[model samples]
Target: MKPFDYLSPGDPAEAVRSVARNPAAVFLGGGTNLVDHLKLGIVAPDLVVHVADLLPATVEDLDGGGLRIGAGVSNSALAADPRVRERFPVLSQALLSGASGQLRNMATTGGNPLQRTRCAYFQDVTTPCNKREPGSGCSALGGWTRHHAILGASEHCVAVHPSDLAVALAALDARVRVLGPDGERTVPFTDLHRLPADTPERDTVLEHGDLVTAIDLPALPPARRSAYRKVRDRASYAFALVSVAAAVEVRGGVITDARVAFGGAAHVPWRARRAERVLRGAPATEESYRAAADAELADARPLEGLDGGNAFKIPLLRRTLAATLRELVGEDAR
Candidate 1:
């Protein structure tokens, strides 16, 4: 790995100030993903600002029925929290479905949302990638792109955002609490990530000296069943090929409300707004589920016959959403 200066700030303000002083500095949490990229020569930050001391290690419930998950809270801790498991099962499931037990134990909530893509071309410095190096062109565009994006992709880049927890957060309408040089601010989780329109190099909307301090999950109503389902090449330790995080409320045999977000199929955690619109006030039937799924994938543009692998994501995604909806509704009825 390249040589880099290291600093462990005493607090969030110090950390942000340190990062601001050094423009080429990156915050280090678990170092699971960032360290790997540094060794791969994909990222060459001159300094490493450690934030382990700047944040708390556990989450606390606020008085107003919201959760204040510390930035340094580990995935295992967050998933094992009784309040989270009961109130936000989708978030817990999404966290557990990602990485492995060891990695999860080491991974933190703040870092999990900022985890970079696993695109082969982006990791290999030998290959040209717009995300790794802007204006250099993307090798994955014509290379092994079976695992690339199907939506919100630009000609400059087609890499997918690789975060299962972020997808669930997006669906839950969670808010990201950040501390920067200016002070504190809360950004919606959906707005945290950006699509690869013209600048694929920027992964998030975070400013140069911003630090994620905590994540606030608002309380969801009772009788609303939620779950996360991921399809991958293996049962575990593999990234998703197609994943869906959904929550639906069924009353009087009709859909009262629904929130859905998709991963592994787009440049960002894709909110199924179109599907949600179609399902609201509609009957909770197989036909309605299929129609809602179809509406979501209608504009998906999948890459075909890349690396001798046919892209069947459009239909597969539709089916996955349908199955998840059915499973959630069925479980709620019991």
Candidate 2:
């Protein structure tokens, strides 16, 4: 690992100011993914700014029944919070479906959204990785890419975002509060991440010195009866090969409302707007669910060449999404 200065700032503003002063400076929350990349020489920041003391560590309720999750809140704490468990079970389920208990204990809400992909080439410094080293070329384009992206991938990069929490947040229409050099701003959770486009090096839409302060989850009526489903290579301690976070409101044997997001299927937590369009006002049936899922995945461009093996993920994702929707109306007293 490279030598770097560690800054222990007690104020969030001061922490972001330090990042603004040094472009190579990065915030340290749980030291989960960032520390690993430092050891692997994948990232070489000149300074590490510890922001644990700068952010609140509790989950507070908003005036209108929404939830404001502190950026410093641990994944385990967020999942176990009674309010979260009762109101947004999908978020709790998504957190628990992720890495082991130990990692979740250390991972923080802010840090979870900043996780890098687990692509093999990106981890190895010897190989060419557009995300790790832009303009060097993308090794995954013609390499082992069973877990790569099928949506929003460009010629420069085919990597996927690996965060279960993000998928749930996307479905809930959460907003991320950020503190930067210019001051404070809020961005929609779905817009936090950017497409691979030409700048594959940049993972998120956040600019220099931006620090996530909290995540504001808006009041979602359908979220009360939502669910999260993950399919992976192993039973546990593995990333999702295909995952769905779904919220459905069925009334009079019709889907009155629906919100869905998919992980391990795109460069970001892909909000299924196309599917939601098809689901709203449609009959809550297996046929309706199938059509909705298909509409969303219609634009999926599976990679060609050696990495084309991930094409199967398209069908797998479709099935996973349909099955999750089925659980929503499976027990209706029709």
Task: Point to the candidate with the largest TM-score.
Answer: 2
Model 2 C-alpha RMSD to native: 1.1
Error of 2 at 205 (Å): 0.8
lDDT per residue for candidate 2 within 1-334, as digits (tens), equals 8999999986999999999999799989998999999999998999999997678899999877789999999999999999999889999999999998999999999989889988888899999988888789999877888898888899999888899999999999999999989989999998899989988889899998999999999888899889999999999999988899999888888889999999998889899999999999999887888899889989898876574568888889889988898887776616
Clashing pairs in 2: none
Point out where model 1 deviates above 4 Å.
222-224, 331-334
List where candidate 2 sits over 4 angstroms from the true fold.
305-308
